[model samples]
Target: MIQMKCRVLLFVKKNMPCVKMMKLSPSPDLNPLDYAIWSILMEKACQKPHPNVESLKRALKKAWKGITLVDLVKIVDNFPKRFQACIDANGGHFE
Candidate 1:
């Protein structure tokens, strides 16, 4: 595991110099958008069979248009509570 981590860090430092300078101590949580908006979008987009790439893209676009600022703000507002839950759980995964 230590060797694997070292290899990963080495690879990051060599190939992903932009992210190499980022702190390695604490990991980040999942994006709130993934938890909130993405699920709704996926549900709407996949509600019916697309049958073609264009249809799928159209469905996704429709879903994207459905997202409102209020939805985003609600997700963003919940971030602190979600993060606190993670901290309370000693960095374990939280809903």
Candidate 2:
């Protein structure tokens, strides 16, 4: 079952680039969740240790709430530019 799913995923991954609408690479540079959101969330949530799993969840939730609409909009606004940079680099590393 897993193998079938993997094969289907691989087929999609191979064809997605030909579509030229989205980049399917798992590079951190290509993913805002990695390049931006996680770091922001981590920094905000990990200022101190949590006493337990519930505490950690609460801290993460509060940190997420603290992220402002303007900040999110700015991050989203930069997304296209980042995609262009990735394309300009031919999927290689870029600043």
Candidate 3:
């Protein structure tokens, strides 16, 4: 993720010593977790009512648990193609 904002960038620099800072365009569309996992989780969670914090946590946990390795492999396997598309687009929407 591109950490452009000052406060967040400072926080990362202060706390995450091992992390390297790099410049890259924001490409949320090409993020596998955003495109795959979150949409699935949102669909599943929104299908039911989460009336409280516990319920919301429960729903999110269930949704997270439901992501199979097979599904993850499928998503990750598309990364190279997606990254290439992102590069080809010069950081435009690559989804």
Strongest candidate by lDDT: 2
Which residue pairs overlap in candidate 3's backbone? none
What global local distance difference test value does model 1 have? 0.67
TM per prediction? 0.63, 0.63, 0.62
Give the per-residue lDDT of model 3 (tens digit) for 18-72.
Answer: 6456654255766556767788888877687878889988888887777665566
User: Which ten-residue region of model 3 has the weakest summed lDDT?
Assistant: 1-10
Evaluated at residue 42, the lDDT of candidate 3 is 85
List, residue by residue over 15-91, the lDDT tens digit for candidate 2: 55543435545998877677787888899999999889999899888887787655565665676788899999999
Clashing pairs in 2: none
User: How accurate locally, in lDDT, is each candidate?
Assistant: 0.67, 0.73, 0.67
Encode model 1's per-residue lDDT on 16-95: one tens digit a residue. Answer: 55543443234346455556767878998999898999999999988888876556556645656876888898988766
> Candidate 1: which stretches are off by over 4 Å?
1-29
Q: After superposition on all CA atoms, how large is the RMSD of candidate 2?
A: 8.9
Query: Could you give the C-alpha RMSD of every candidate to the true structure, in order shown?
Result: 11.6, 8.9, 8.9
